[model samples]
Target: MTDIKVDHIIETDVLVVGGGGAAARAALSAAQAGANVRMAIKAKWLTGGSTATAFSELLAIAAAIGHADERDHPEIHYEDTLDAGRGFIDPELVWTLASEVPHRIQDLIDIGLNFDKQENGKLVQGMSDFATYPRTCRVNGVTARHILVALGKQIKKRGVPIDENMMVFKLITDNDQNISGALGMNMETKEITLYKTPSVILACGGAQHIYKHAVGTSDMIGNGYAMAYELGIPLVNMEFIQIGPAAIKPSMTLLSGPVWKTKPILTNSNGENILEKYVPENVSIDEVYTEKVFPFTISSAAYYLDTSIQKELELNPTPNGGVWGIMPPGSEEIVQEKIPKTNGVLKAKGIDVFNDPFEVALVAQCMNGGALIESPDGTTKVAGLFIAGETAGGLRGPDRPGGNSLAEGQVFGHRTGQAAAKHAERSTNSANPEGKSHAALEDLADWIGRSKGKQELNDAIVSLKENMYKNCLVIRNEERLNDAMTYIQELEYSLENGEFNIDQENFSAAIDFKHMLTIAKSIVLSAQTRTESRSCHYREDYPEKDDANWIKSIFVTQQNGEMSVDTRQWPHHRKSEKSEVKL
Candidate 1:
């Protein structure tokens, strides 16, 4: 407690709490609209958020895919999004995203987002599976990264105040539920920051790293999700976990997604394309693989590697799940380099993905749903608080469409910022009823400083990650979940014995991993309760969708350190007082 420091104060009309594509755009939009906005990021600005991991990182992704002419209105986009989300989406929320997506795409282009174009200046496009039109778009192949880079420079040009390498411990609100601001524990000096503002926006990204082996970065620990839930917010789709289909011995084959045409034939170690035995006839090649071969593990897993089919397969998007599809040119190299990164763990476990694709397993990648903050127009049940990008719900279900999330960041972040500003302007609440900001900051700073126990943080996290990889990814059953829950309990008990020493940067791996454990518990709990398979939550007991029994949303909220899950019935889409502000 003595080591704690209270460093600074940041006040703004609107506070954007993330640095990714969505957060950046949100801040820029708000600031440009004359709102005094400040953004805070937990890690290196864009690096920690989802904008860094998009498929192509292109601007106007859907436009590049095919809707270059605005032929697709928000209504069409809304229906397509709702359909993809499989009834779990918030009707009004989907309406919001769909309605604004097209104009937002145009806004990116207007702001110097260099999307790919043909000789005639028409947008270059392709179909990345299941899209209503050729909606998959790209510029340099990595849409997420490209957008991050561009948005990075774009925001830097605007000179927004940003604080990085800080841990936001909790959301602070007055008794009236008006968001006064947030409290943060500085990683460097163990001091805390108390922010008093009209509005608070959470742009914190997904909770994928909570699982053992993940393509997601270390910072992807559901911190934002946890904070929102702690504040009594509902997470829309907590059960939808996205797992990539390709792995060579437990290492993901990033480039392999675009290679080897026509769903590589699944072959066992015996070099047999296992599709022959179980894949029923009449299914499309994509269906034959994703719906049939990919799920079944015959003695491990089997996959056909045909370099010869590269051209044919790349033409048809192999990563058919997301809005971002594999673009040509870099497919082989991306696959080649990324596939081997999984070696250390796989080598330690004795599996070779190249020689045996089946031997390669899974690590966690992304969670499609989370805490229900507000729509782009920042108004949660808890007013004065807003959610952005991945932290806010009603965007994706268990399975997210590619390119859509990046778009989400732009649209919602901006909306939330503006709405928050509007709320602040209209609200009659006082900033501080009893001066809690300073107290809250000091308390958090002290708490962060006091984590000086002597348990091995890294080892426990590694174990947690490994356990999650085996139990939670791709294949899951009740027994596995139960075992994992028990294992996590013992691990948590052991963490109390470790030596923390309150080193922020030095002990970030520990902090990151600890947060992962917390988030993993929620995921497993939600996954365990659903008892049925749908989209990303594929339970062996309930392998098929039963709309009659499970047609609504899975609302998971955490209270009193316990996660409570409930089923929300889908409501008819209603249009609220639609704002007149259009890009």
Candidate 2:
């Protein structure tokens, strides 16, 4: 066996593997708890993760602080969250998020983060889709960016070390299956480093980029999901993915709250209003527009709006593979008033929404499911390893209320950080896992050495993305999902057989493609197992929500080197029934 050398070995009490808001907050909390924390990111600070990327004109952070509405409270938020989750949420986690997000928001404010406020110094909370009250707060349209910046400032002030452009590919575990450390490579220099830590936090975000059209940054290719799955962690609710409309032509920004209010004219390549064709006669286009916010959910008539755009793209796709959406004559005034930041962004890009028609497509937004956690502290079955933010699953379900993601990140990030710190303090340092690290490197070396063909990795990635977008997007069915699964399996086989060339220049991309393939297959398998239409996961073959049978969440896990699927009833299902809130 050929030996692969590790360039550096560093030790920390807690290692956070991500650059987003969750990772930043986790590092801050761990440091505040007196743990020596370090951060490693695949991209430069503030440019790689979903938290730093601008998705919409108004990215809301939901918390029931009663600043905007007196009736709003944590209990209402908890009930609303359960209702939106469709009985698939972890009630304890939901309560933790609902009750603790206000404190986390206060922490952000204490660290110099300012939310939008009214003239009287009260917070300007807005109503997000599926929410019962005005509970979402924002910083104009770029809420995530501002939150990340604030968290970054705190991380710096605490003197937590951050290693930029370090792509972690393997989680090194001891013979007992406890997390010992992690192995990563410097993207720029290709130098491998081993992180020796008693505790590790996985906050690497979601795998939305596996789809052709997605709102996530390119680096969010399911690093956390892939690593956890490799370590035999179960992922839940993988089928429930948020798909929504986004401008694809002039600029790739989410066409959410304010954009829908414009009541834009949606047309196909033939310049015909396509919404009228898809929307039923009983449901008017006006009603669809009113119900539409961002994601395509089955509970409202807005589903037809997204279906119309998707069908148009599949049938008569424009040059940009999207349908045309033209804002009305007087809607520019509304845009300016409602989404001034987005309006300026479009104007700067020479896209006059009121005058010219822009291309809009159904883009993958967020993954509601990921690595399953056992507690609010984001602890998985695996000891010494934790997950938070979009990387951790079971906190959300079928349809997440808008702005809940930001709150989840902060809430769980804080909990996971403190818990990991405590775990580190209690842990006794065992012998170094140098042999485990070598085994991981040997596996990587073997894969690279066996490559004898010349198939381009980029082409395979494009095909995977296109396939995922077509079959696994908002509208899904048995046949298409099976086909996608088959294709993914074939790709996996090809990769293992070394049909695709592995070169130094594309090594990192090859690793990312492998992770994407795994994630995409998990999504397809989960979507196929559900066999019902619910929230973002719509099965045309079933076309109905089966609460009696399908209310449970689907779980995917890697067992015996093969992927398996199973189902589990929500932990708080009975309790949820007792406290069910009727809208």
Candidate 3:
């Protein structure tokens, strides 16, 4: 077989890989910094990633704008973030994110993001389950969509070139382990394109789709995480992922505060309330149900709500294959007001939240982990490579505050864009580019050309998702986590034996299979190592958060095709004494 050649080559000062809110913000910021930027997306520009499809209770963009509460400052926001993280996040990163978020929110407003406001002209802020004040800013619930639309308009106005339907396959690095360019393949034509640039920003989002019950775009299979891991970048917080109840049968929409406000009784197939039996007798069940915390959190009592449901699922497999949500009456207005997008989903399914008991289950939602970055500028261990959004982790630990994820994207996206431009300007190699990008494409094309697709490969992928959900999701145990490891190792063995094929039609799926497998293994590995139960990572055997011993984070990196996992203490032992915000 001949070496596969790149069909097209594009040169830019910086490359942003993703089309979500973070990528859009980064691209626009880079262009504003007078950098020639090119962006590649797996789908269309604005509506392709998780930001566009987010359908939970009001998608939050947390910023201490002091709209609702004048006392809601960055210090309070930073404290709340630390409390959510359970001593696992870097204090500096959290401080940086909280400090800059208000400015980033203002930037979004400048770009035409119409945030909901009160009659007094201040932005209307609301509270999630865990908040010192109302810091979550939203637009009737579609915060992500509106943010994307606003950033999309800015990118369009700035004239940044966007390559749609182009899936970035790998990052090309020079001999010094410095990122030089990237290789991508057009989804429609399967032709390879090489992007030559000094800087690459990874906003490719998270690996929530690694589970069978996932809530993000299908394309978010941790491509960024896998590429960074393969390139020897250490990833932190792989064990921590957010899960929440979402509609299962009618359609997948977030069953958030409003849905729970209807006093939905979680029942088995026989219509018996299941949660009463599992929750502690001392805990108030009403408060747990009305906690307004969508994500299953170990730090709060609401976690019992999900644990009880999981218990029921194990004992009796329901006819619908999920726990039934018997929503109380008079919820129509609340549903419409809180989650307008979910209202559409319910209407399309013909199951009114006011009338019917819909099937709801705990589904994997947001990933709070990714390639570790050392600075607020989103600089990764790999030079010339940066990351933001869910693709970067440092500000979040065992869990995240309600709106911090989206806000982190905006804050760091702006910094990364400017940083990439400066790096591009400082780099000396501009006239003559290397062929490593083409070489990477040739390797990928060679793998794609050789193999015949197999049904077993697809089945294996399904099994991977099932194993992760069963063992590594909301509830986990030592035995089950070990079982997950075995299954992942066996799948890896199959890949080594050439049992799977990379046919053109299943090319992306096959590639995603590899990424998901790696990411799943890492999650299970990290979960198994962390003996204490903290936040979303609940271990049944280790049913306590051991702050004395488990306050540090586990960092995983790869060398010689093997992963090395180690622990690192949080940099700061105490909060900063200064009360003034940095920005």
Candidate 4:
């Protein structure tokens, strides 16, 4: 084994491994709890992760503060979330998110995060799909960015050390399987650093970028999921990834909210009305458009619209790999009024919504599944290692309601940060494990010693992404999933055999390929194992929900140097104050 030198060793009480909204919240809470906190981000602070990059006209955080409608309550929010999850959501997590998000929102407000309000000084709230009332809180459609700005300011105020351009690839555990520290590489200097901490929070977001068509930032490539999975953490609901319509041509912005209400004409590359051809006879275009809000789900007629576009692109290939959406001449004013943010973004890109045809495609937006947490505090089965944000699963289900993603990050980020700090306070074994550190360095050295050019590695990533997009996006089946799994395994074999080239410049890419392959295989295998059509994970072979045998959540784990798949019954029977909602 080639010896690799560790350039630096840093010590902290709690190490946060992401820079998104969740990570910011975690770091802030940890610092507030009086724990020495440090953050390692693969990209620049406040410039990466889904929370910083996600945008839409209706972008808001779901909180049942009863601002828009007095009828709204946490119970209603919990019920709607449970129903939307399609029998796979954890009841406790849903309740925690629904009940505690209001407090978290208030915390944000207390920290100088201003939400949009009406003339009466009442907060403005809008209704999102799968929501009972107008409970989504927003600020001119860029709510996430505003939230991040507030969070970034608070994070800076707390004096938490943040390490940017640091890619954490390994989680070091002691002999008792407790998290001791982590190993990271600085992307700029190519130097290795070991962070010694008693507690760690994995909030690195999702791997939607593994798909060819994704809306998340490039840094969100499954670093959290892969690291947790490698550490024997069970990943749940890996198959249920949320995908939705977004512009692919002029700019990569989400096509949601009032844009659908405008009744824009959707066409194939040849200008054929694809929706008319594929929408069921019983479903009208008006119904499809009305039902379409954001993410693609099998329960609604809007799926026909997404399916039509997918089929059209497959049959008649477009240069941009999307269908054209043309807004009516007079509807431009309505779009400008209703979806002003989306309209402004597109207008800046030189595509007038009234005249030019915009390219739209089904883009992977978020993952509903991730490392399964045992509590609302984002506690995984692994000791001293917690998860939050998109990195933690079981909190969401097959379909997450719009705006809940941001709410979930705050609710659980606060909880996880506090829990991790408490755990760190009780921890006595803060010493770095030399054995694990040496092994991690040896592994890094092996990769560096096998370094070659970057072309082959780049080609492999492109091919994997294309395959994942084609086989594992909105629509899926057993054959395609199996084929994808096989291809992924072949890629894994090639990577192990050093068939693809890797070098120092592309070392992050090489590590990303490994993480992507691990996550892709997990998704494919989990999708195949489910064998039922539900929510975002629609298996065409089994075209309907099999409630009898498939009401359980699928879990993927690494065991004995191979992938293991299993399922566990959801805790639907767990008693709670709001347990009246049934599957």
Candidate 2 segments exceeding 4 Å error: 1-3, 573-583
| lDDT on C-alpha atoms for all candidate structures | 0.61, 0.87, 0.81, 0.86
Off by over 4 Å in 4: 1-3, 450-455, 577-583
* Per-model TM against the reference: 0.79, 0.96, 0.94, 0.96
Candidate 4 overall Cα lDDT vs. reference? Answer: 0.86
Give one digit per residue, the lDDT tens place, for model 3 in 311-395.
7777764765578875566666665665666667787888766667778777888887788998889998788999988999777
What TM-score, to 2 decimals, does candidate 3 have? Answer: 0.94
Kindly give the stretch of ten consecutive residues in candidate 2 with the minimal lDDT sum: 574-583
Candidate 2 lDDT tens digits, 97-152: 88889898888888988899989887889888767889988985689999999999
Model 1 C-alpha lDDT per residue in residues 1-583, reported as the tens digit of each score: 5343446677677878877777777787777777777787877776675667543212235532233534444555556776666567777777777667657767767777777776877666655433565665567566667666776776778787888877776677888777787767556665567677877778777887776545546677888877777778877777677664444333333322333232333433334333453444653445433332221221112221221122122232223211122223434444454333323334455543334233223445557877775555846877778888877777677556555666677778779867877776777777672266656645544645666776556767777877776677655679878888888777655544444544554444554555566677777777787777666566665666676777777787767876688887666455544333222
Candidate 4 per-residue lDDT, tens place, 1-583, comes to: 4456678999898999999889889999999998999999999988888988888887899998887887788888888888876457789898899888989988998999889998977789998888989989997668998998898898888888999999999999998899999989999998889998889999999999999888878777898999999999998999888888888985588887578988889888777888888887888889999888677888888889887878877887567898988887778677867777778888888988788888888898899899989999999888899999999999787778878999999999999999999999999885556678988777876976765434488789889999998988878988888889889999998887677676666777788899999999999989989888987878889989888998888989999989999888776734557422110
What candidate 3 gets wrong by more than 4 Å, as runs, is 280-284, 329-345, 430-434, 445-455, 573-583
Q: Candidate 4, after superposition: displacement of residue 431 in Å?
A: 3.7
Give all candidate RMSDs, comma-separated: 7.6, 2.8, 2.5, 2.7
Which residue pairs clash within candidate 4?
A: none
